[model samples]
Target: MKIFKYLILLVSLSVVMTGCEKEFLDTEPASSISAEQVAETPAANEALVNGIYANLRTYGVGGTTAHTDYGHRGITAGLDNMSNDVVLNNFNWYIFFYNYTGRVQTSSRASLIWNTYYSVVADANIVINGLGTLENRTAEEDALFGQALALKSFALFNLVRIYSPSYIGNESAPGVPVPDRLTFDGKGRGTVQDVYNQIIPDLEQAVTLLEGFNRSSKQQIDQSVAQGLLAEVYLETGNWAEAASAANAARTGYGLMTGEEYVNDGFDNIGNQEWMWGADIDSESSTVYASFFSHYDSFLGGYAGALDGYKLIDANLYSMIPETDARKDVFVEAGNEFGFPPLSNTKFVDATSSFEGDYLYMRSAEMYLIEAEALVRAGQVDAGIDVLVELVSSRDSGYERPALTGQALLDEIYLQRRIELWGEGFAWFDLKRLSKPLDRTYEGSNHRDFGKFMFPAGSNEFLFQIPEDELNSNDNIGAGDQNPS
Candidate 1:
């Protein structure tokens, strides 16, 4: 059997990884071989890792993955729903999501996101086990196994957020699928706790597995990435002090980027400082071209410019951004091409290679924010406020706010989250986690709901109908039970 030698990716490969999808599996990236061949040697592991990343980069069979980033914002005020012929058409779905009835859902974005991350988990398993089957160990063999575990744990953490309700709502809410750790099996939806529990062990294993190994952002799983991911999971689980510790660990090892460095470095000469971990996607091979930023109103011109009439920045929410925020400059008006003010989201906009240089899965700034949240949640309110203010001040000089605690402090954190993470896809879960009110306005432009709002959660509409196929195909788990009103 024909087999190439390289089994693991280099840090630089992270940026180079995305460009050529078609050639990915067949052509060797540092190495290549069939799965059976990999069971014999470490060469097949890279192909498997490539497959895992593809799942993260592209939407899968059901298209449930879109919600993690763009769609998350869509459900929140970061986006304006243009075709609001109904509540669903209008983002007013946020208003009355629980009351929604017409359950003709296509892709919740979160659903696709969940499926894709699971695939990443599976790919990690393949690498984890396949590496063991090899005889003589090489640096290549070790790298493949370590990277696989970190990436897998990373994917699972994201799934927990979307599928399971937030930490605030139900600590025990049923979460999403918890994938097989050492093996790949797509079956089973774990309770929210089950999935959350699965992540910590996996991450701990990754931390141990990846010890001493070092590589750039692309092919290797470094200590900071694991720590950063763990901190996030801890926060999600409301282990505030642990969350703060992990964030501190992550931030300490990976230095912070100055304000300018955070914005420009990742794509250029300063790349090392800003990213703790990110997918290295290049210009030529990128399919997404930063689609969220592509819209016309962006002035920066991303894919959204051509898609027409969909994904507007919510006027109600946009108005809340104080003019002083450097972050506010991230959104640009595309000149109402679809009709309304034509606000385009540009935070992800990268002029390099269709504006989607690479997908940053984790960054240093998040650790700062994570620490701030965790500290505050742990009852160190003033300390947390100090961290947040220091961090935000670096991002925008004049942007200022008074120290706050209790509910008020949390609210301030929430506001920053909405504005800062906007199109990066953190909104829907935030609202749910915070238990924000849901209501709808029917001023939708679509033909479906010329003017009616509805709720799709809690009382009016609880469980999203299981994907049509699962209901028809999987007898073990048919239409899921609805959420309580």
Candidate 2:
């Protein structure tokens, strides 16, 4: 059954020729064909690209768990557990991630993340490389080619971020191998700078190519998506001005959601104007136990809130949210109706009790936060504060722009970011980039295991080891090349 499922996914990768309607890529192909053979026509090429998006939600890489809707939710859960913001109240599937145990060079989760992303990258390369074979290229073809590049860049961007050290003074550090084409030959690790160099240009080209192309659905990548990704890349590389500019470019057509909309709605709808990129999980196509809601949703999830285990928001951070802030209501306070732990999150729930909920990949609010952070880092303190005030005031009607500067102002902005983007998967990355220590020893902390409570800044546990399979199979990477255990 597993092999049959994989075969179906592989065949579907080349069979995306449905029609004008923007729907999920759930159509099974009549037969299998090589990716190169699949991109012969414009429709075929477009389908191939669409399949990449579909592959994100289906069984592969992060999607190994049955019915787990393994794409963004799987990645998000793992990433969030690695940080201090979200805590596991009981031993669950993600307990290893929460404790940073079993994340060794050979761990299955690490391997899944590595392999699944590379699979996307490999298919994307086929589409990108095959674009030149077309006889008469149109804007659509250019857009397809552009989307392929952007997707490829996105996969590589996340891979490098997870597998390598921060680019800050760590440019020379060993990073994941930069694969430009689909091949089995082993390639050695490159420097962290090498991967960034590749990612930046690919996204820049994608932004240019996708300029006038109309997308069938929000699931598809557009100019704004490329720009948003570029902004994040710039922020990671410490290119403050470019990050701010790219963020503003990405925010052109989107606006922040009203406080009422945020609190009342379960955040399962991708149609919300605040969402920039997302996976629209149709009810019929829902992956029951494997879906995002099954894991993250308080009322609907299998592991969180009123379920087998609980997902708790960091108590210290929760205390920082002012009562005036509407976002504070997203989490259930201790002694609330749910009987959940203090600061247990209720931010995500399926509209019905079912596990069918759209998974958000990126949002406009992230862009606003990125712009603010970039501006502040670039020495435009007041301008940055103004941007933040604009966002915060919307969530907290009584918010008065606090008088803050220097590190204090930066800290405040970071705090707002944590509150605004919690569970959306920024916590771990932020902690790593800021070189912050993980200390879960505070009062009311949910992390009870002493052995896993604190890891200092620059600890070996910060980066995931290259999968043991890769080290064993690839000649370029060996045991010595593994991240510190």
Candidate 3:
């Protein structure tokens, strides 16, 4: 059996790990396999692909052992904390994010987001470069190659959005560098347009290559997942028709969870039919204290439960949820049986109560929302509303198809997105894409007192400054390249 070494990021592979401030080192980075050990056979290729997925859930990928640094979920938790919708009671793990300090150039959170995504890009580049060409490749080989492209595209998409300004008016703005497997040299930042140009084509090719490929797990990217990713890219780039089409295509087979399913099964299961993509965390894979459940699951004796680190829906947002809505039940009300805070969430309880709650990365509900939003934005308001009604009706039996039109209807869709996807990490990015301000200081605000400051649309505070380490290490990004603090 052929086996390739599982290489973590080498200084040569990713910009993040490239050693020293003054001059780039030729020395091997900590925990890396040499180029010579990289194999090209199917079995070896499969192992490399598995490693890419593992990085999505692996702890300490951000070069920190901080409990808040556990892979993608950690990033999501931070992002949600930055939004007004999710409120944290205490200043323990995500205080920086809540107070808008995490995006500062010097913060570890900034470095964590930059390093982790770039590392994924670096690893994906290795798989892509190893595979070489698509012509005459076997079915297994094509799928592997496509997955690598999709992963790279996914990583770059996140990086560009995090570091650069929104796509619409800021296409010419500085974006993250697009490095490939063989690009050993340091590279300059691409424009936002340049990054999306790479992202769109890569996802398009992935959509084609992954056709008819059946993944063994939801964690693996397949044709629909790639389509879903493409839909998101299109939506961000303001390609409304393409976004709607792709989103509609992406949700073809997945069904929404019924009210019972939503209320009974805590939103911690990867096996949920609505969950199109998620991490299937178990005893072995679970990070225990550093896991998503620890922070988010209020009933599971984790941080939120035992340490008073409870997260709650913003009072303003919570008030919008109808009493009849099943989604409202997830947030523990006043005089609840649990004796927790009035709005402490019971939405994310670990079914095992063992800190093994599965992480939701992507789901069909997001696609339906994306399709509806894109359709409405594209002037297909009725079609978009139809999609919205189908999704909302599943969660709220009393949901009435609104007679709202124009911005009112679009606002309703946005409200549904907030209600539906609140904790799964879309809030801050959604604010950025929509050019909306962070408004947490309303009359009935539940935001942490320190986090009450509001910023206008397109505030520099919304941007995560390129980390100082990257500026010092990568010759391309400099003091001038940093986003305004």
In order, what lDDT does every prediction score?
0.52, 0.78, 0.82
Superposition TM-score, candidate 3 onto the true structure? 0.93
Q: Residue 208's C-alpha lDDT in candidate 1? A: 65
Clashing pairs for model 2 are 67-290, 68-290, 69-290, 105-468
lDDT of 3 by residue, 162-272 (tens): 888899999999888887557545567879999998999999999998999999888789999999999999999999999999999999999889877887888889888
lDDT for each residue of candidate 2 in 275-392, tens digit (9 for 90 to 100): 9998777755566776677777878746564455667788788889999899999988768986677677788878867776887899999999999999999999888988999889
Off by over 4 Å in 3: 1-39
Summarize candidate 1's per-residue lDDT along 449-475 as a digit string, tens digits. 332344444322323333444334434
Q: What is the TM-score of each candidate against the true structure?
A: 0.73, 0.92, 0.93
- CA error at residue 468 for candidate 3, angstroms: 0.8
Q: Worst ten-residue run, lDDT, model 3?
A: 18-27
lDDT (Cα, 0-100) at 468 in candidate 3:
81
Please report how far candidate 1 places residue 266 from its true position, in Å. 11
RMSD after CA superposition, every candidate: 7.2, 3.4, 6.1
